[model samples]
Target: MFSRFVAWAKRNLPTRESMEANRWLRPVAHRVLEPSLWRFTRRSVPRGVALGMVTGILCPVAQVPLSAIFALPVRANIPVAALTTFITNPFTTPPLWVAAYWIGSRILHFGEGMGVEADAARGWMEWLFSEAGPSLVVGLTLITLVFAVVGYGASALGWRWWIVRKWRARAEARAA
Candidate 1:
């Protein structure tokens, strides 16, 4: 199921060859269109996910370009990195921000009552200024780091599992 999704996504993404034809991308084509950055190796995909998570969660607006920047240097799967930016869309950002503010307040000792007061306040900007602003920044940073780590670890584990599964299948076939 996931593999099918990945395949479809890969297909939908503009190929390196095509993207290079763009006047904007032409000058930097050598770096952006690096072959290793586009391949779907076990290592690249997870690193791409991590890079994407970092830029997507932290930058929000420039996630795609930021991911592309990081992916090029790290030789991560560029398409996967570009695609993973949607993790923080319009529907999901509000809740994540609220949760981050809450966690940040707790960590920074603004206390639960302050958090409640901030929440009940009229405007987000006002509530942010009262006490939660710094905490919110801290919380957002922490959350981005956590998500990036988790994404990278999960991909690594998945890659390892895939290798093991393939080995077992090959052994079974040979035995038969």
Candidate 2:
């Protein structure tokens, strides 16, 4: 099972020029990542990593689309946007949608305090059309606004920090 998984991962996540680059890059990656791995043992690093993962997993609608936006400004650190993709992992997607629906309901002041079930949220648009056609517009608008605010803010901060660090490193390297 492990070998199969490794094979699949290698096939899907191939690094181009692996033979040439790995000779040098592998050692450098290991050296750099060693400290990062050790730093992950600290509480703050784990918290930051968790926040990044949650932001990626919980804000799928915003994260995926805005990853492109982050990619534009921080072209050198595309990996940050790529890492943000973890927010929409297979396990967290359903719950995220349900939460979005619940948030939408709250913002619209409809179904007050009623926890949104996945099935109910999935059919919410249809229900709105039948039961409260006018309210559907309000619900959709509220959902968009809430998601945009949360997603944009989190992704912007993450991307901004990533870009700043990269720029700082380049500047320091030039100075050296």
Candidate 3:
């Protein structure tokens, strides 16, 4: 199942050549097409995962391009970074934001005066202008940082484990 999904992604996702030809990226096509950034090394893959998580969680718009650009500086795997941005799509965003708000409320001790329910009753503009605004911003920032750190650590550990497993499997096959 995972192999099929990977194959599908490879076939459907834009290629390096296609990206190079992109009108918007034409100015920096040379840098964007650098070979090192596209390689799937252990270091690059983990960096890409972290970068993707940060960009994906922090912003709802242009995450793929954002990750791709950031990946260049970090020498992260471009495709991995780009694909990871799907962590926050239309279907998952609402719930994620709600969770962020909940977390923010807890951390910031919101609703002490009139209560959270009363705050929710206010108009959208008023709510946004109130404590909810700072809470949401702080929550999103904290969530983004946490996700990036966790993503990086998990990917690094998973990559190391995969390599070790492959080595062991190869040794067993040779012995057989």
Candidate 4:
């Protein structure tokens, strides 16, 4: 399973050479193609996951590039960060936004005074501008932060678990 995942990742994810050849990234290719940022170390992977979560949730477009840009400063695993941005795609975005709007409304209580009738009278655009807009923004911000923290912690724990499992299997093989 892990080998399959590695194969898939290699086929799909961008390489250092591809990134370096990118017209937009060419100017900063030196920094972006740094060897340390590309390594799948314990420290870098979690940071990459966190950065990817943040960029994936907050950015509407160019999430891969954005994740890469964010990864530069943090010394994150660039490929992992770029791959993680797939969390927020076309199929998932609508539901995610709806949930964000719901959460934001619950937190802000923005709908307390405004009735459906009043909203209808004002028009959907007006209602969105007055109520839904801020709620969505706040909710998205909250979701992004939560995702980042959770992604980082989860990835770190997962990495540790994988390493331990591998060691245990190796020990069993040696004993046998």
* Candidate 4 colliding pairs: none
Model 4: per-residue Cα lDDT over 1-176, one tens digit each? 99998899999888988877889878888898899999999999999999998899899999998898889888999998998998999899999999999999999898788777876688778878888999999999999999999999999999999999999999999999
Tens digit of lDDT per residue, candidate 3, span 105-168? 7788887678777866889888777767778888888898999999999999999999999999
For candidate 3, which ten residues in a row score worst on lDDT? 111-120
lDDT of 1: 0.86
Stretches of model 2 off by over 4 angstroms after superposition:
1-70, 74-76, 112-125, 128-176
Whole-model lDDT per candidate? 0.86, 0.48, 0.89, 0.92
Query: Per-residue CA lDDT of candidate 2, range 28-121, in tens?
Result: 4543233332232223232333344434644546563344233332231223333435656678666665665665555557655557684376
Off by over 4 Å in 3: 115-123
TM-score of predicted structure 4? 0.90
**Clash pairs for candidate 3:** none
Give the Cα RMSD of candidate 4. 2.0
Model 1 ranges off by over 4 Å: 1-4, 111-127
Per-model clash counts, in order, read 0, 3, 0, 0
Model 1 agreement with the true structure over 1-176: per-residue lDDT tens digits: 99998888868877887888899998899888888888889989999999889888889587898889888878789988888887999998999999989889888877555466556655877656866788889899999999999999998899999999999999999999
User: What TM-score against the true fold does each predicted structure earn?
Assistant: 0.86, 0.35, 0.90, 0.90
